[model samples]
Target: MTKTDLRHRDVAEAAASQPMLQQVERWSAINSGSANLAGLATMAGLLADAFSALPGELALLDGAPSERVSASGQVLETLHGRHLRLRVRPDASRRMLFTGHMDTVYPADHSFQSISPIMDGRLNGPGVADMKGGLAVLLAALSAIERSGAAGSIGYDVLINSDEEVGSPSSAALLADLAPTKIAALTYEPALPDGTLAGARGGSGNFSILVRGRSAHAGRNPADGRNAVVAAADLTLRLAGVASPGLSVNPAKIDGGGPNNVVPDTAVLRVNFRPAGEEDVRHARTAVEAAAASVARDHDVAVEVHGGFGRPPKPVDPAAEKLFALVRECGRMIDLDVRWRSTGGVCDGNNIAACGVPVVDTMGVRGGAIHSPDEYLIVESLAERAMLSALAICRIADGGLA
Candidate 1:
């Protein structure tokens, strides 16, 4: 066995059950919904306090600028709370990046708040699996490596963003800035229920197409009216048919319309699409534009399309596969089996991979039912995943894998 193997085993064994569960319970208690600015600010402070245990310069940097259309159709920009950044061993020969999110899908007022023990050694609650639990695992693994005195061999930055659950519109730029020249990346998005990892994620984009047309009194001059609502509906149907083996399109909702006596003059069609790769993304965009233009021309309306592909596809390149192999090796050392498959969902890993960085993003606790009230974390995987992550980092630090 290599010296790296021995050290990793020692660290993994010591790393488990080092207040990791308690930290999860504590952190999961707070509500850090993506749109809850106050809650996110408080959660950010809590993260700063918790991650301060590591050896690094910790800073709470301002979140990136993001814009959204208000209910009145006015475009407005909003600022989120600070995001956590910790730089450890900045001058080390090798560097890696670690990322996790502090936000959940549940709003502050949502009723799903408390953590309760479920059957089969699982804990059910909001954010327990969809990533507060993952953050706990990351801290435990890093603590073990730091205590082993091997942290200096591998430099890394831990980014805990407060806006990941909302497609990371604000944090995307921050990730791009930090991704250059990184050898590998680990993201603590929860593993699948059976502990399978996410590999080769498809890229995702969100779009809002606004339509404007001439309104008329339906009872008096129905022929003179151009219906924007009908135009939006036509566009939705056309876009849904654009999905192919390489692309998935979803027309989520439409907004607009009024009383029966009036022809609706304004409407917005909201959509989401997942593409297999860059070419797929390009094709999907072209298809959406052509469909929208056809609908507008037929309905005599003006259409404005907004938003583009924010998260790029993350394919399992050779470098990424090597990292996965190392993770599997560590899993075997700890008597854990690790499997992976391509995922339709996208995350921060997609953004990191777009920078030419190889990333294994599902390096977190095993769990299921994410983004729902039934979300849960397997109690045993807390320690198991921590060990796996610590061992993998140890292998990377020892130059066994790049």
Candidate 2:
């Protein structure tokens, strides 16, 4: 074998030797749901301790302040857990960003809290595929890179945030700040079960519209009352009609209404929008505002809109294509076939791409049925993906991607 091949084999072997499965088990055991502040704290602490094995300056930083509109039509500050940040070789000319999330879609009271082995080397558990396994792979790969002495020429910053499943409201700003400084970025969101990566992701926006009107007794003065719930319902239908081939709108829920004896004065409609591109995003926003205005005028209710798009659309630009090509080449060296296709799903990669950074986001384990009780991680992929990532990082450090 050539010297380069030998070097890659050594790094892969090193990555395979780490206790990645054990780490996945330990991390998945904790319920670090996005809204579970206490659980996220515990998970963050454990991650900080595990990631400390690498050479870096690590700290647990508070999440950015977040706000949300309540069901009662009042805006309230939302609390989020701390995020773990690690910076290694900050002065190096070639810098990269590695990102993952500690939060899972499952809450503390979720039934899928325990892990169990399934058939064919698969393990089922909460966040096992959608990212606890990914985190393990990331640690193993970086550790292998360090051992191979390949990280010296290229520095990397690691950010494992507490909020990602909930649209990254608290960590979006942090990601934006770090993304511009990196030449490339890798995010540990799981690959498909067949190991296909996600490319050219769509953007996501969440909105809460509050409707207010005058209340009166239903039986005696119903005609004198302007029903806010009815207005909110009208708004929901209008928003849904805004969907097209490029933009999808989901009016998820409406929160309001009281006893039938009186007209409800307040209601809040929660909706989500998925835009295929920047033009779609602009069209969706305009549609929302225009629909709200129409609903208000027709119902004689005051309408207020809150929230904006957190993840921008990620297109396959030339820089991103270069990064993907580099990863595919590394996968070939390891005897693995790496492929990617466009997906409607959005992640922090979308935010990073908005900052003009080339990022291959699905640098994680192969898995399927994410964000559900059936979520499973292919046990073998722990080492396989780790090797792929380590080789890619080593190549980037060697100036392969530029």
Total clashing pairs for each candidate = 0, 0
lDDT values, one for every candidate: 0.89, 0.93
Per-candidate Cα RMSD to the true structure, in Å, reads: 1.4, 1.1
Candidate 1 TM-score to native: 0.97
Measured against the true structure, the TM-scores of the candidates, in listed sequence, are 0.97, 0.98
Per-residue lDDT for 1-402 in model 2, tens only?
A: 678768877897799789999999999999999999999999999999999999989999999779899988899999999999999998999899999999999999989899996678999999999899999999999998897797789999999999999989998889988989799999999999999999999999999999999899999999999999999999999889989999999999999999999999999999999999999999999998899999999999999999999999999999999999999998998889999999999999999999999999999999999999999999999999999998888888888876
Question: Candidate 2: which stretches are off by over 4 Å?
Answer: none
The true-versus-predicted C-alpha distance at residue 244 of model 1, in Å, is: 1.1
User: What is the clash count of model 2?
Assistant: 0
lDDT of 1 by residue, 70-113 (tens): 53345678777678999998888899999999999999899998
lDDT, model 2, position 304: 94
Q: List runs of model 1 lying over 4 Å from the truth.
A: none
